[model samples]
Target: MTEVRGVVATGKGKPVEVTTIHVPDPGPGEAVVRVQACGVCHTDLHYREGGISDEYPFLLGHEVAGVVDAVGEGVQDVAAGDFVVLNWRAVCGSCRACRRGRPQYCFDTRNATQPMTLPDGTPLSPALGIGGFAEKTLVHAGQCTKVDPAARPAVVGLLGCGVMAGIGAAVNTGGAGPGDSVAVIGCGGVGNGSIAGAHLAGVRKIIAVDTDPAKLDWARRFGATHTVNATDHDTVQAVRELTDGNGADLVIDAVGVPQTYTQAFYARDLAGTVVLVGVPSPDMRLELPLLDVFARGGALKSSWYGDCLPERDFPMLTELHHQGRLPLEEFVTEEIPLDDVEGAFEKMQAGAVLRSVVAF
Candidate 1:
């Protein structure tokens, strides 16, 4: 076992601390990653707030770009020194989803059998099965996807989660195309990512909706052809007006609240798709009319991790970023040290930054 410093949230609504932890050598199908960069995501905040679970002393941080430090027996796909992006869902090939050729929806994902723990031997529940806030972490070999080593870690690491989810929501789930008018609600990191995805897919009219002016400005950088200020206009009306009173071909709700979701439901063209990519609270409930659901004549989909197959999508997106087709680096607002996680969280909550990446 090797000692490393990592961010830990010990209790509900508590600030995370950088403390000592122990990482064991990789076992079968496991690998150790020396994390180079990890992006701070809202999910990490959810874990700290006990919104995810009551698992205390949680090891936080997931969206990771790292180098393989070691691999255990039977690991063949990746070896030591490979630069990789870590994904939470490591598809188990034998699972029903994989057997059906839809591995992105793998029901049984893989993680390391051995646990990283505190110096006193208390096992830490790594957030999203990654716990990449440490200098090094152990994970299933399948969780690490080899990407171009030339890509910046801080920029590429964001692809491990929110960015990938947003892009996947638009390109994969929504099937946005060159002729489609795509409207994305929220304009946060994930929202902007959807806009970027639409842009990458050659969408002609990409609309961004948000209450925050700063966020809307950020959305333009990712390629929003139109911006809707939710505070200033009725979201559905605005989107419809922009799309010739027919609504958009696709509407994505990156803000998972009922109001935004309702807007998304109403802001699409007949037979258009509505994709919900936001993470909503458990207590929040929706009461949409069943009649409206039937009348819409379109699909209402919830995107889980953007419906992405990491092995296939990661390399392709990384290549796009390398080719300057996808502006992946624009998502990073700041680079911080491991000790500034709390400050990073504060910045995120205030909507002051798209991403604050911890560079080790």
Candidate 2:
């Protein structure tokens, strides 16, 4: 086992601490990653609050960019020196979803069999099976997706989660295309990414909706043709007004609340698509009229990890970033040290940052 310094959330609502932890050497189908940078996502905060589960002593951090340090006996896809983006979905090929050729929805995902432990030998549950807020982390070989080494770790790491989810929501799930009109609710990193993805897919009009004007300004940078202040205007009505009395060709809900979802449902044109990419809590529920569901005459889809095939999506996105076609770097609002995760989380909750990356 390799000893490393890592951040740990010991209990619900308690402050996270920097502590020494043990990372075991790769076993079969596993690999050790020497982390370069990791992004502080809302999901990490959720995990800390026990919103995810009762897993205590949680090793937190998921969106990560790292270099392989060791490979297990059976690992063959990646080598020790390769820079990679860590993904949560380590698809099991034998699962029903994979057998049906939709590995993006792979029901059986793999994680490291080995446990990372605290200094006293208490086993730590790695968040999202990544636990990237450490000098090194162990994961299934399938969790690491090789990206361009030249790409900035802080920027590329965001692609591992939120950014990927947003981009894939538009391009892959929503099937956004040239001349299509698109509207995205919520102007955070994910929503802005959806706007960027829609632009990349050649969408003619992109409307960004948010209560915060600052985020709307940020949305414009990502190619939003129009902005809606949700606090002052009705989102669905504004979207319709922008799209010439017909709703947008596609409407994506990046805010996972029932209200935003309802707006998305009403903001799409007849036969248009509605993609929900934001995550919701178990207690949250949506009740839509069955008659309206049938009258909408369109598809209501949920995008998990942006419906992405990591092998295909990660490399292509990295190339786009390298070519200056994608604004991956713009999503990184700040870079903090590993010890500043708590402060970064505050900034994230206050909407002061799109992404605060932890650099090891």
In terms of TM-score, how similar is model 1 to the real structure?
Answer: 0.99
1-360: candidate 1 lDDT, tens digit per residue: 889999999999988999999999999999999999999999999999999999888999999999999999999999999999999999999988899999989999999999999999999999999999999999999999999999999999999999999999999999999899999999888999999999999999999999999999999999999999999999999999999999999999999999999999999999999999999999999999999899879899999999999999999999999999999999999999999999999999999999999999
Candidate 2's C-alpha runs over 4 A off are: none
On the 0 to 100 scale, the lDDT of residue 77 in model 2 is 97
- The lDDT of each candidate is 0.96, 0.94
Task: Kindly give the number of clashing pairs for every candidate.
Answer: 0, 0
lDDT of 2 by residue, 1-360 (tens): 999999999999999999999999999999999999999999999999999999899999999999999999989999899999999998999999999999999999999998999878899999999999999999999999999899989999998899999999999999999989999999898899899999888899999999999999999999999999999999989999999999999999999999999999999999999999988888999999999999989899999999998889999999998898999999999999999999998998999999999998
Worst 10 residues of 2 by lDDT: 114-123
lDDT of 1: 0.96
How well does candidate 2 match the true structure in TM-score terms?
0.99
Per-residue lDDT, model 1, residue 17, is: 94
Model 1 C-alpha RMSD to native? 0.6
The true-versus-predicted C-alpha distance at residue 321 of model 1, in Å, is 0.5
